[model samples]
Target: MRRTITKFGSLAAVSMFALALAQPAQAVQAAGATGTTAASSSAFFEFTDGTDTFVFKLTDSAKIQQARNILSGVETENVGVMGKVVKTPAWYNSPWKYQIAPNSVSFFGMAMEVCDASISYVDTHLNEVGGALLPGSTWCPWQSKLTREVTAP
Candidate 1:
């Protein structure tokens, strides 16, 4: 059961979305200019599906700020492109060995993680992520939101 997704307004209305997906390399460089290592500058974002809280890391300074803005109510874009879920050590505080593609972070008004599929479906079908589940390896939790900014462990 998919709900009706809302479309974002013109470009002027969602400037943060554009900024979030901006050049990540440039953002890392900007952080370096300010005396911070790429890893030290990484920001953590927390999203919730009402029952569960998911944490993610954004290495891009621009995306970090954009995520902070979204959580602070400055940006209304509540959806993000989750990219690929890596089978590495969990970047977030989850027991599952999954982490979203940091370089692929971006905001969207409406997105389907794997063409109208739910996150649970993807998790249950993680083995087929890059194959059938998420052919392109992107997971956009449509109902997810930037609930908070957290400190990395």
Candidate 2:
């Protein structure tokens, strides 16, 4: 009788331990099924055109910082004229001025390209004159761009 009682007590203790370990996993699974596994957020912004908009979805704060850095010129490419064949700077890699809003970010800048005498001439002669060819100057039309950040709801 004594041995039997001891065996039963051991089994009960093991069962309780197993139950305790399983509880957290069950709770996690339940939360995942309900789509509440993690916190989510999003941001949105519009271009200078005002009609165009962009959105970004971020899973963590690191992504938000990356977007900020990109806009802040931390990783901006140099201002240069685009060239044919070699494929001068297009839209994405160009330097842009970014603005952070309550729920979004806005980016605006001009894209430089090596055009025929028409575009370059207007830029150099009329716009530049003696001064340097400043980027996004009167010679360069507003590229008009925007970007936004988003995350799971």
Candidate 3:
């Protein structure tokens, strides 16, 4: 029994060594990662709902402009990337909302209306950004996405 146990241990060591040699270098770097990824300042919004925060990373100029328009209440139509639906899900021609599984979300609007209207307020203020109907809101500071591509030595 002792001899069999020793042999099995040796075989396990050899298999581990072989597996390590066959693995890609990327896995090693990732495992040894001492760095982290960051967000960019190219134009992104930080949304908050008291409990959680959402970061919308805007890249495309048109989409960014659409977001701007939506915020400004001058957007022609609410379609595709122009909707106020802020979920970090990249689908269709737009990126997804960057929130962490937000459910029971409420938009800013008036009473007696199925959907409240931040539109009227946005139309006047244009640069106004808050969610009265949606409890609380906050403008997050600039942040960067971490780029942790490491060089394995």
Candidate 1: worst 10 consecutive residues by lDDT?
1-10
TM-score of 2: 0.26
lDDT per residue as tens, model 1, 45-75:
7776555566777887788878877877788
Count residue pairs with overlapping backbones in model 2.
Answer: 8
Over 4 Å off, model 1:
1-40, 113-117
lDDT of each candidate versus the true structure: 0.68, 0.38, 0.37
Clash statistics: count for each candidate: 0, 8, 19
Instruction: Write the residue-wise lDDT of candidate 3 on 1-153 in tens digits.
Output: 999999999999999998888675665466558552121123554343333333444544454455566555675344211124332343321222322222222222222332222322323332333444322322212221111111211
Model 2 clashing residue pairs (backbone) = 41-151, 42-150, 43-149, 56-148, 56-149, 56-150, 57-150, 58-150
1-153, model 2: which lDDT tens digit per residue?
A: 999999999999999999999998898788789887432443332222233332223333444454556556674542211221111221332232211222222222345442212333432254342245433232222433333332332
What are the C-alpha RMSDs, in order, of all predicted structures?
12.4, 19.0, 16.7
lDDT of 2 at 43: 35
Candidate 3: stretches off by over 4 Å: 1-41, 48-51, 76-153
